[model samples]
Target: MQKINKINQYLLENYPSIWNTRLVWMLLLGIAIHIIFFFIGFVSHGSPSTLQHTRAIDDYFSTGLVFVHIIISVLLIVGWLIFMFKNNAFKNFYPGSRNKLFLEFLQYFIIVFVSTTFYFSYMTGFRLFINYKYDDETMAKNVDIINRSVPFLSQNIEDYTLENRLSPKPFVDFYCETDINKIDKTKKYFVYHDRVYQYFRLYPKTVKQTDERGQFIYPEEEKKNKTALAYFENNNDDKSRTYYFKQQVEDLSQYIKTAAPSYYNYSAVFYDNANNPSTDIRKYRYENDINNLNNKEIYKQKQIVINRETIRILEKKSSKELEKLMEDFLAVSRDFDIANNLNARDWSAMVYHPDTFEVRSFIKLYQTKPNEIYDPNKAPEGRYGDYTKTVVVDSAAVSSDNYLNENGEIMQDTISARDFNPNLDREVSPKDYFKNNISGFYYYTSDLETFLGNVDTIKTDDFFWDAVHLYIWIAFALSVFIFSFRVTDLRSLLFSVISAGVIILAVTLFCVAVAFTFGFKGTFFILYTILVVGLLILLMPFITAGRFPKVVSSVFMIISMMAFPLFIWLIFGIVNEHQVAGCRSQVYVSDTYLNCRGVLDDFGLKISYAMIMFTFVFLYLYTGFIRKWKALPE
Candidate 1:
């Protein structure tokens, strides 16, 4: 004990400034701890430079790992700085010793500036490299995966082309009324089926092709349209006859549905009477039978088929084989519909019930339903109205301030029209707005512009507010430094700034971890809720301490430092989540989300909290230092 006392006395006399035994020991301990943890981190998790190659998504595990790494590194740096200051390592070389406060400020400012620049540069560079890694082999693998995933992706175009190519021609012969002849051939009308040939084929060619008076004749012949054949082959005939009929019904339903849906129902045309028939001809067998029987008249012709090959194809084909063929055709049709941007509901209907997709019925529905094929971007004039023009076309005719309606009248106070810029909207054409303004490919140019704009706006706004916030932090630090050190020296100010920053960062990190870990769950949620409410409790005593003003002020300062970031987090966390969700959903490209997600995730709760805390400390110290500004003698 006597020896220790002697040593302390000697130290106090010989090294009055840097001879505090307790601080010296603490400095050694701090150094040891920092080294140990840093080494462990390097061994367990590869260096930050190496970890740059790791892929991360907007999820907890990856983000948490990164956060822990950054937080630990910051803590170590701050701890070492604190140890150096406490041990008076810079006492002789300190900037304030030469009374050069500008040099001190300039040095710290460069440190902050360089650190911020390097961090952002490193992160953005890594992100760019990762995004561009999709080379030819990777692209080929992706294509193959997509093809395998969706069976129809490869066959849509092929099937659509084949169906269209084989579709039967429209009816070339139709029976109609004429002033000159009782029965006249009309080329304009279409008979849904090939009944003309069906009826004629039954009679041998040796029989007179034309009956007396040059009038074509068929008394008893089977009517055969694709629809009738389809029905008879499935319901009315034996397997042998069914197969023969099945070959006749070519899978032209897709084509006929589009070509002439209203007229393509039945194939045969029947006169009211077989002889001395009236001008009226009926396409339905039931209607012809009823009309002829009611009027006691027989029609001139019963049924006919023109195409022989239509029936020959199914001659020996089994029902199962026909079913398989139909399945293949349906698959292609369905695929084509999707490829051509067909309505999902319509395509589903065609696939589910091909039999219901009759000519007349489909035509009526198709004509009445809205056409989904049209593109607003490439619409002809007078099609999509002026709204499409603002979104799709680039023109000064409708400036941001003055939006012209179709009638040439200015639309007053229209928010969308007033703020409409091609840069913000994803639909803007490459040739119009993107090519000149953006550097990257045309596809992502508009989205990149919007995302970058969002980032710029956020950063500028943050800086504007942060400038004031920074003043508060620096002012508080300055007050604390002067009080603690009993001196208004630049060295003290620097120590104070660094000390305050470490505390704020440490507290902010703890709060962020609490929030992130709890994820607003039951007990953790309650803890935060109490902390948020207790802010008022922490403030009330300071506000009401009228008798002991100095004590109250000191207590208030401490409480405010701890609670300020939490307050900001609660308010802005909610706001930022809303902002991110809105912006993310609106962006057409994913990179915007990728770029912004790290900053905005957890509602930017962590980032904003940390930023506010740091800014508050800087602003608090700086504000006080400025009022008592003085240039000490060199």
Candidate 2:
């Protein structure tokens, strides 16, 4: 019994060679490494991460990637378990070699590939999913995604009209409604857009069904055009159109999102593939007789039914009667909802009257009362937070809402930028946008708002840094493959292992440098493929370091470098545009920002060029092949 007990103890102690080796440890270590990189990417990327914090931490993290990470983690653990339990796994993985040290180092390479493949799956899957703008279930439908979403080419600016829905209500925080209680009736009011004369409708006490030019831009259409259209929005303003983003990208972050509520302006939003019945609400587009006010009569609703008999138009020719009508109209409307169904007059500006229909604010046309021109001296200040200074830009001189007294004298109710001039302030104004109109300046705020996010490279890292992460893993993978063939002679074995390592790192490092110059794009995969092919081509020709077949290796490496570039050129040429390329969005964004990621264009060529230079240097340094090919026998 004593003999058997000692024998059992000895077997147990010697069987497991390394205490650190355990299925749990393998999984833990692999998972830890992945997590480390993921976190680094998250930080460098500066986007929200699902794993960095617990559920309680909501301020900065996105829950979007959490479940996917959990699934990946579980899969990795399973893979580790499979590797640990299968006895034959070693037979296929770890092989003997003449150089014990090389063999030992190679073992680590083996594990990384198996583990990496498992970890790499998450990225691959996510990228594939990204090809779809929204989840399978929630892609925008009925409401066709504004032409920018699909196809290699899209519509031009002229194709769009005042009614084009390419841009939804994209900004929320900036617009605010003015108090109607203070009206400078005689002074022509100006809206940023709709540069037209305002003829007040007597019956509705609002802007007549149409304006002087017959352009039917009502409340919402006018505001959107002022902010997003014109020279700034379309580059039509001067020589540039993509306002703020295209022209005034002073602070990229500020443009990231106008505010939290309006993400579509900045953020690339997507829903879960399984999300049922997408949240798109384009079905309830309102229709009323507001399209043609000249012919249509108003609807009088009682007990949830319309009574057309009550739709008589009371014509008040005098100013007092008009004033009473205006008062009645103002008091009646809390919001304007229905618009452009029939005519401008058909639109209703309800005063908290939820039943007639909810219009936030509709047109209000009144008879023009002759008033003094705007006096910058009277209204010294504006309600906006501060007078913002501009750069050397061609901006229009802007005035704030006028400050008037009860007697209608131009009083200092508000202030004007006392020293504002386009040359001095360099900021565009509503007047600049609405060059044609100063008539009743229409202003109102709407909940039709948007949120935005900037598509930017994580500030903490650049393409070079991103390349380094891959280098380490690649190094590990190459070392494993080279060291696995441990049956060769010591000189040859050492030569092969070192040669493989140098080639792997050379190609990768060269790629790193080239990628930084060009852009990350597909350089990594290109270099990786080249390195792989180069190794395969060189393997048979250069069996050992002593027998270094310099020409074979050089030829192989050259081919490897050229292959990636040739493929890149072929792809770009065939596609006819950048759309088909990988992560071209990054390239597009970079082009906007001093062409920061411009390196993507020539990365493949740069890599090939680098290899040529390397070849020349290598040939000059290594003049002749090793005279006595084989190293001394180990």
lDDT of candidate 1 over 18-95, digit per residue (tens):
343233433444455445443433343222222211122111134454465456445643553464457454433333
TM for every model, in the order presented, reads: 0.25, 0.26
**lDDT of residue 620 for candidate 2:** 29
* Superposition-based RMSD of candidate 2 using all C-alpha atoms, in angstroms: 20.5
Model 2 CA deviation exceeding 4 Å by range: 1-111, 120-135, 138-352, 355-472, 475-599, 602-632
Residues 1-634 of candidate 2 have per-residue lDDT tens digits of 9975665456447633221123234545766666554453334322222111222122223634444545654575456546544543332333222333333443444444434533243332332332232222332231122111111001011111111111222212121112222222343322212111111211111222334543322334334443221111111122221212111111123222221111122111111112111111111112222322211111101100111111111112233432344333333122221111112122222212222211122221112235644321121132221112121112221122443332226644342232212232443333342222223322111100000011111111133333434544453434333332322323544455466577669767877787788876673466456745554653543453335454444433333322333444334443323333444555433333443333334464454444434533432232222211212232
